[model samples]
Target: MKINTYIDHTILKATATVDDIKQLCKEAKEHHFYAVCVNGYYVALAESELMQTDIKIAAVVGFPLGATSSYIKVEEAKHCIDQGAHEIDMVLNVGLLKSGGYQKIIEEDIRAVKKAIGNNVLKVIFENCYLTTEEKKIACKLSLNAGADFIKTSTGFGTGGATLEDVQLMINEVHGSVKIKASGGIRDLNTAKQYIDLGVSRIGTSSGIQIVNPT
Candidate 1:
């Protein structure tokens, strides 16, 4: 399979500069990646750079930590979409999920964001490192129920990144209703390929260039 099509070529570092985002957009266009995932602040810049191309712009909300209020995340999603973001990869409220408020709080949060974005794609980040197997399953079910387009594994700024087991578990739990995105710590070709082999529909990482053209 063509690996480039599965990548959400990403650069979400706090230190990322305007030049960095420009370069990222350039690289994504040249490589024909599925999308260029960037911080919400750079959505406009990335959009300006990627205009006229088929490449998509994906903005992050709630980021590495899902501790922000749901209201804030929804606002961020709206602003990014207005700035031309085609997709949103939002972090789920891990605290709410672990506090036994999974259905009431977390699910509602995701649903609100989905409604705000309307027809745009929404990928809910679970930050899987913080959950147990059962919690992961519950989160997957909640994401699908909440109308998420994709159930993402990590934010890449978490304690750990994606794992094969988490990818498989998420895929099995969603049962094809929602897509799976494997992100974080995927630095090489073999690791990325393994996740794809397990049926992951998208791969999120800053190492997209390396994964596509490993030396």
Candidate 2:
């Protein structure tokens, strides 16, 4: 398996600077990662740094907290695409999903962002650590129904990261309607391989270098 191709080399730190993004793009190009995932503000910088390479730039919307209005999320996604993001990883509204009010609202949230991004890849972050097993299933269904390209396991900022059990549950739930992205705690070759073995289409992590070339 080409593990590097499965990785979305990521740096979403709140304190990330332009230099950090430049270094990120450099490493991504050197390592031949599938993409570089960064915050929206730095998509243009990453684009400029990676324009010569085939590496895609993924931008985050709604980020660690998905409490923002759907309109805001749409705007964020549009702005990121405008700034040159080839893909978007959007946070699902944990509050709304937990509230159990109307599931359509959550679906609409994904749809709005997907619409804004057009053909760009859209991965919806479930932050599975905070959800129950049933909630996870519901989230998978909503994301698929809303046209998400991938269903992500976590935000890496959540209390817990991707787990084998969660990935399995998601795989069973989505049933290939959409691809899966296992993020968060994937920091080693073995762990990353484990998720890929479990059928994740992508691995989102800050440890791409470590996973591909461990000490």
Candidate 3:
């Protein structure tokens, strides 16, 4: 399989500079990656650099922490889309999901962002490291119900990253109604291959270079 086509070449560090985003965009174009996942601030810059290319731009909303208010996440998503981001990777409301009885609230949160983004893609990040099996399944359901285009595993800044079990669980839960993205800690070729083979539609990591060109 063509690995680059499955990669969302990412760089979401808080310390990421303008030059860093430019370089990331350059690499994405060079490698013909599916997309370059960046922070909201860099959406326009990445867009400018990636203009005329088929490569997509995915912006992270509410970042590693899903603690931001739903309103904020929606606005962030809107701004990113306006700045040329083609997709949004939004963190799920972990606290609300764990609180129980807030399923509707959580779903609405995702839906709000989905609404804001309109025809663009919306990926709801479950940050699975903080959830149980049931919670993960619930997250998948909620994302699907909320019109999310993809159910993502983790935010990569969490205590853990993607796992085969989580990806499998997501696959079984979504049942092809929605796509899956396994992010965080997926560094090497073998690991990326594992998730891809498991049926993930996307891979989010800063290690796409090493994965595609391992020395």
TM agreement with the true structure for every prediction: 0.98, 0.99, 0.98
| Candidate 3 per-residue C-alpha lDDT over 60-145 given as tens digits, one digit per residue, 9 for 90 to 100 | 99888888998999999999999999999999989889999999999999999999999999999999999999999999999999
**lDDT string, candidate 2, 49-155, tens digits:** 99889999999999988999999999999999999999999999998999897699999999999998899999999999999998999999999999999999999
Please give the lDDT score for candidate 2.
0.95
Candidate 2 Cα outliers beyond 4 Å, as residue runs:
none
TM-score of 1: 0.98
Root-mean-square deviation (CA) per prediction: 0.8, 0.6, 0.7
Q: Is candidate 1 or candidate 3 better by lDDT?
A: 3
Give Cα distance to truth, residue 81, candidate 2, Å. 0.4
Compared with the true structure, what per-residue lDDT tens digits does model 1 show for residues 153-178?
99988799999999989988988999
Predicted candidate 3, C-alpha RMSD: 0.7
The lDDT, on a scale of 0 to 1, for candidate 3 is 0.94
